[model samples]
Target chain A: MLQPLRDRVLVRPSEEEKQTSGGIVLPDTARKRPQEGEVLAVGAGRVLDTGLRVPPAVKVGDTVVYSKYAAMQVSSEGEDLLLLEEDAILAVRD
Target chain B: MLQPLRDRVLVRPSEEEKQTSGGIVLPDTARKRPQEGEVLAVGAGRVLDTGLRVPPAVKVGDTVVYSKYAAMQVSSEGEDLLLLEEDAILAVRD
Candidate 1:
């Protein structure tokens, strides 16, 4: 398990046609870029200028929608993953 | 005077060839985009997830270099100004 640091999240991106939940799925054109994923790991929180930490909003196993251009690709054990800041996560799917 | 809110900074951008300071100036290609300016006003701070405020690093009248694409254009009394987040500021010139 990769441990991310400070407001970062490790995500396993969902594949095409397999991202169905709540009877809604992304279109093909939108699916070309990884936008939604399952949260695999979450960092502690963001540090403020005063040294206080702001806890992350999401937790493990959350299905989240993030900004397309905000994800940084990382590979862990032959599996492609995404690393994102807490601010990059746009919404959580119920 | 336009007052900004929530970690936003309002700046009056310097024109081409007029941004000289401390014996350094940005080149023409870089000058095409507004990258440097004098901060006119600043918001209180950024509100953290915990509702704590992170004080701004830059202050009014400071000369700063910022991310070119991060600025939002606003006009005040017919004078064009730029609004940016504190994070968009890359450096403060002496």
Candidate 2:
């Protein structure tokens, strides 16, 4: 497993579907906006200028919506994943 | 004077010129890349998950290079300014 650095998070994007595993239905308007994914792993947190670390907001197994344009596609162990900064995450599904 | 929030920086982009205020000449390839600007104001720093703040890297009057696509154009006091995250800053021209 690859560990993301800084505030970056590793995500496994959900397949294209009208409904998510968490039972959240995607509205048509949201389809063109953000993409949905499952949190595979998160960085320890961003290192502050003061050398303190801020813990990640989303943890493993959390489903998140992230900026479509900001997610970088990478393949690890033959699995396609997304790498994005915490700032790019828009919302977390309950 | 608007105080930017959380690692945001207000920059006054330099006018198109072959040479920067720091005496660094713009390379031909750099023309389409980053833009040079003067730091006007800096945010307190990004608030960490721990509620701690990270100080900004660039201070007032510092000349910097920032990503063009990440900069947001805003107008204040009848002057054009660019608002960007501290992460957008590529380098500081010492």
Residue A61, model 1, lDDT: 97
DockQ of 1: 0.02
lDDT of each: 0.69, 0.71
Q: Write the per-residue lDDT of candidate 2 for residues B50-89, one digit (tens) a residue.
A: 6666899899999999875545545457876766779989
Instruction: Give the candidate number with the greatest TM-score.
Output: 2
Expressed as tens digits, the lDDT of each residue in B1-94 for candidate 1 is 5556557778787774235323333345334544778998887776775667799999989999886453455556787676677887888999
Cα RMSDs, all models: 12.1, 11.8
Per-model DockQ: 0.02, 0.03
- Restricting to chain A, the TM-score for each candidate equals 0.78, 0.79
**Highest lDDT, which number?**
2
For residue B45, model 2's alpha carbon misses the true position, in angstroms, by 13
What lDDT is obtained when candidate 2 is compared to the true structure? 0.71
After superposition, candidate 2 runs with Cα above 4 Å error: A17-32, B1-50, B53-94
